[model samples]
Target: MADATPYEDSTTPSPTVLSQDITLNWKTKATVRLYRPAVIPPKKKLPLIIYLHGGDFVLYSASTVIYHNFCNDIAAAFPAIVISVEYRLAPENRLPAAYFDGLNAVLWAQNQSLGIGGQDPWLEYADFTKTYLLGSSAGANIAYHVALQLLDYDLRPVKIKGLLMNQAFFGGLTRTQSEKNLIEDAYVPLYVNDVLWSLALPTYMNRDHEYCNPISGGSYMGRVKGLPKVYIKGDYGDPLVDRSILLAQYLQSCKVPVYYRFNQGGYHGIELQNTSAAQQLYNDMTWFVNDVYQNLNSQDLSHHHASY
Candidate 1:
């Protein structure tokens, strides 16, 4: 059975933002909740952020309380169009299942951009040229893979500016220092992570499966050469911090422009723990999105929005 979005009321506009749900696939219940700033700046097409929520790929929905609040905050703060994807979870639907749903969500956005599907008014303000995939933990993993999935697609009018990952939950067969040190972690125990892997990964695969550990660098790793500029962020207290470090190292070696912000201390998903951290994250995200226009892209964002 597919999990339903548990949020009872999403239509009412908050002071900062407004949100509503869209059912992308009726059968599988694949859905996306679209969020936009309440008072959209007229005549200004904002950047598009296709967000995947974090729950070890086995828990949470796009409408889950924490993820919803996170999206609302960022949509208002970054003042961008934030589309949160709700895909089926695992122990029932595993690995590639969530990944494919991520791709589908992106395709839906593509259709909206090309005006091929039923269009929504908020999406009309999306500056596809300034698009981004933003996710945290397991969602970050999905964002990275989905970005790879779109590599072959022609990106003339809609280019993904960059990826924004926060404490990506990557794993490996051999333990890193942080993983070993944090095995007895209070917030995220290693035992719990193992259980999640068992549920989310394919029956035949283990922790080292490419989906869990991209650091192994196989065919999928080679494809990452075409990845957009990346913004990877993590805190020192998380066990997976080492894997985040390893991923940043590998991408840098591949000559992909990788921006990293590793703070001194934070548990798994610190942003969810309090306001200060989330604000700092929003701070980093706004800077990154702005930097994408100022540095990674050739045309000025205002000019791009006007001309396109």
Candidate 2:
């Protein structure tokens, strides 16, 4: 998979877009690619978006050309600072490895926001207080796990206001109607999904594991209650659509604020392949981010008044 190069660097140079790669942890070989708008006034801070690229947990990295292009485009479109995390993959690093790396990346971002970590020009304008965790496919799964981990600790000035899962990769022991119907697709086939789960999940664990299937219950049910507002997108033709639906229902059951969008006649990862679809998804995401920002401001104001 590493030898397979999907596309040449087709990223159009934009005066408004600027990006750089930074190492998060040397020992774990975890890295992050930071993207932000080039123009910013003095003391201006932008919402920080920590992006996890999708590759079924075993395929791609932040350096992948396609993902790099996606991150660059979104950074410019949203006009926010995007930190695309390069977590350790599976079959070599396995389950929990990527999750740990993701958490570490968030912590590293926190340190940067607090001015304790090594300097980076982009992070200087990052508003960690209004952070968002976003991912697609397996990356979205990683983002979910990382958010759960974050709940265990108190992170001041680095609040995770929302989570955006674009066609999130999730499965279970039982087959859904979409999965049975859409055996083969352009992005990810049924067999490929099965293989990815095998490679990513622990040896003893099956598809029912909480890592692969959050609704399988165990720890996830308890953790789901405190999760931030979640926005989930699903493709009609994708096999994983049911998984997203189930997740939305589960979140709603837990009384967590959840927003979901399902696209018609779309396959898994269609946004990455279709320009129009990608643009629409980006627009939706921007709206979600704006809504979250307004809520954050209101919450802060309420807290301030209560403190007084």
* Weakest 10 consecutive residues of candidate 2 by summed lDDT: 299-308
List runs of model 1 lying over 4 Å from the truth. 1-14, 292-308
> For every model in order, what is the number of clashing pairs?
0, 0
Q: Against the true structure, candidate 1 has what lDDT?
A: 0.82
User: Which window of ten consecutive residues has the lowest lDDT sum in model 1?
Assistant: 299-308
**Model 1 residue 36 lDDT score:** 84
TM-scores vs. true structure, each candidate: 0.90, 0.89
